[model samples]
Target: GSTMSQSEAAMAKANPMYNSIYSQLPQYFGEQPWTAGPVYVGAFVMFLFILGCFIVKGPLKWALLGATIFSILLSWGKNFMGLTDLFIDYVPMYNKFRAVSSILVIAEFTIPLLAIFALKEILSKPDTLKLKENRGGAIATLVLTAGVALILAVAPGIFFSGFITTQEMAALKQGLPAEHLAPLVANLTEMRKAIIASDAWRSFFIIVIGCVLLFLYQQRKLKASFTLAGIALLCLIDMWSINKRYLNDEQFVPKSKQTEAFVKTQADEMILQDTTLNYRVLNFIGFPGNTFNENNTAYWHKSVGGYHAAKLRRYQEMIDHHIMPEMQETYQAVATAGGQMDSVDASKFRVLNMLNTKYFIFPAGEQGQAVPVVNPYAYGNAWFVDKVQYVNNANEEIDALNDILPTETAVVDVKFKEQLKGVTEGYKDSLSTIQLTSYEPNRLVYKTFTPKDGVVVFSEIYYPGWRATIDGQPVDIARADYILRAINVPAGEHTIEMWFDPQSIQVTESIAYAALALLLIGVMVLAWTQRNKIAKKS
Candidate 1:
């Protein structure tokens, strides 16, 4: 059965048009603090909280404290190793902010204190912990109800992680970019918005729980021993199961289309590198392989992407199989000769994008397996070839080789021009345009065009840097990150090209990213410092 080639799949993985958050998971893992340690620490922390909860009195307060601690442990574990799919099943809302380990830690500290404050009101009421004679039955019912509810909440998470859905399986079969699953991939970007909703829900739950306990205190119906141990126990079990899962799988695990895209991408890169004159075969060539003097090894690497390499490899494999033993020597010689010529040819194409040649030649082998290589020239090397040899004789693979292409084919010269036209010729009601002044790497300036009434509508300035503004106004520039940005004008018209500021944009981005990193580092450092400062003050 034929499967889509890795090259085809590469188009998908190389550009993750959507499902970008899935890409961030790896980056988040790299940034997590706990990645340096064994993940089992979370499990250990869970055990400590469980033990502390059961051994302590004031069960609601203790249970709240335990939940807070357990959540923190789970958050860190998920953040570091990317162990989080199960959280999506049970507490889907939590999964969105799981990477925000520091925020979750703050929540853990705040939630328990809030629960304790709520507990204080209830316990201070008369006979809050005291149980009535018939209340044993009520307590038992509450315990069982809570335990069952807990199991219901937890079981789905444990089961869902073990299997992939039919959709994911289908994506793998389709190959790359998961074109069939594009819609699903697109949804991943909106996960942060979904996460915000989850946080609001958690806030609602906390408020409801606090209000109920406060109401009981106000009515004098609060009991000290009125504990929901069943609910607390269920929470403990669920938390423990989640911790166990995290401990078992600490890898940055990808799911569905994410996994398929990642795996296929790796496979494609491997094949391209192996088949082409990449890092493996052409260690001598600089990147883009456009040197004045060509390296044979680099030529071999560049040639692999062309038609010749494909046919050469096919013919060589055929010869190896003895399908055509007598033809092996001639085919091998031709492959070697073509490879040598291609190296020289590739340099000329590297100089310019337009002049880049795109054809290759492969002489026919003794067997019928040989095919011609096409697209021999790349950028800069377009017109560099002066002479070429072809196999014309049987004895000398060189002697047999022939150069059918004319000398002009050796080098290519390409010219591109843009003509300007009269502004009134294209559009009516147009008036005289003002002169353009000043240019930055990504920003350009021009005078606005006014109609006969002197009302300006458009401008006549060019943005070679990518963006142009008129009358100190900004224009929305797309593809500003690309190497070139050009604005066209019609023939017989006046136009000016000015470069905009790219360095400023790049510097701004670099500084902002650095500032963010420093800010995070500062926050963690400050938190630890404050803890020490408080300890000293105490």
Candidate 2:
């Protein structure tokens, strides 16, 4: 549930902290990273990486170096945000990805490749690493690694005293008194410094030991096999020691604590009773922090708001413009009116109803059980809106959602005008109706009876790869209500179905079959070869 909220996402252009790869206070300084990042390649491997740079031969070395350098620079992400922004703007498909530091996977691959090849060079030609420049390179590598560690270990404050960001300071100040906040900040900063210093010493000691072994092997004081074994042992110890810090016995909990973890609250019970096709649940549970970050609501119901990395960009846009503004207004009203379910203006939930949010679970009462508040004006699974309000741009389209009632109108982007095909005008009889007859994650079946040509809006999230059919013939589904699907339907009783059948699936299937056939052929050939070899030996 770490998906960035619409507010934070909107602010991302001005603030780099909201970017996927930007490090945070509790994460970078914490003992264990929240994203399971800061991938450790081991101290010994890193030492070999530096030594390998000088010893590795040919263009392969340069390729590996290039890969290493590319990954490192890209991994800086928001730290050197200009490069990241340049890639996002100019590089094709670069804008589609997040978690920029994940590019370090390339460095991980290249580092090992160079390290192994460099070791091979030394084993094959004993005097290779003994050359003046190569020896100096090796010495310099040790000096650089150890020297930096020594400085950081001795005086970390000199480099990172002012590490706290405005965001971090603001977050820390919450619920903290003026006198106490300073000491807390100081202590945390000291601890962060200590953590870095500790790790620096750890890296320094490991590298020194590795260097000592290399010196011994080069000078004929140790056997080649012993040197290899010692290096492998050192890498194991370093990795194991670091890994144990994150994956330890403390993570285990008692059976009682684990059992019934997703037990239903009273709200869940009330919500589960509603046997409708589908409806989204809202459990902001009285706080903005709970808005999109809590997944507990999703445990038993389809949530209107929940965190996920791959949430639809269109939905995010809707959140930024429609949902967030409406939510803030209602929450503010609720706060002013004394924070009760009755204080909530059900009328203000235009965006919410359009999303078909039926139940809002609030934590209340003596036992603190979830209290379910039914939104009576929920738009249901499907509806026939009176008109399609077209807008010039994204901003206009989103803002238009609030301008008119979502129950009567759908604000659509002008980009989708081609799909509408000059059929923007709509008319739905008050008696005319539509209901979701069947609902599946990928397929939806709806029954609609319209008196005339009208746009039937389904309370389903708008995404690519969905194909709409009226009775049997395929029809274009237009982007409607900012984050919903709507199709122009002819009058009379008809079955409307929408199914997800992405074209990419066909290509993927072909690739899978080809790979399978190749694997089978390889297996058969290998079996035949083994049989022939066994016969000859016999």
lDDT of 2: 0.76
Worst 10 residues of 2 by lDDT: 1-10
TM-score of 2: 0.87
In candidate 1, how many Å is residue 423 off?
Answer: 9.5
The C-alpha stretches of model 2 lying farther than 4 A from their native spots are: 1-34, 78-93, 248-259, 332-344, 366-368, 529-538
lDDT of 2 at 81: 87
lDDT of 2 by residue, 1-538 (tens): 1222212222232234223322323425422224743578887787777888887768988999998998889887777888888888999988777578678889989988888787777766667778987989887777777777778778876665464556667876885677767765655555456566767888889888987887788888888899889988998999997777567676687888765566877778888998887888887574577678767778789998888877778887777777877777765665465555565676787888888888877666666567777766688888877778888887787767766887788778888876766566777777798888888999999888977888777888877899988889999988877778878888888999999999989899999999999999999999999999999999
Instruction: Give one digit per residue, the lDDT tens place, for model 1 in 98-176.
Output: 2445336554454545434534433554333343632353344334433333443334223223222345445544654
TM-scores, all candidates, are: 0.23, 0.87
lDDT of each: 0.34, 0.76
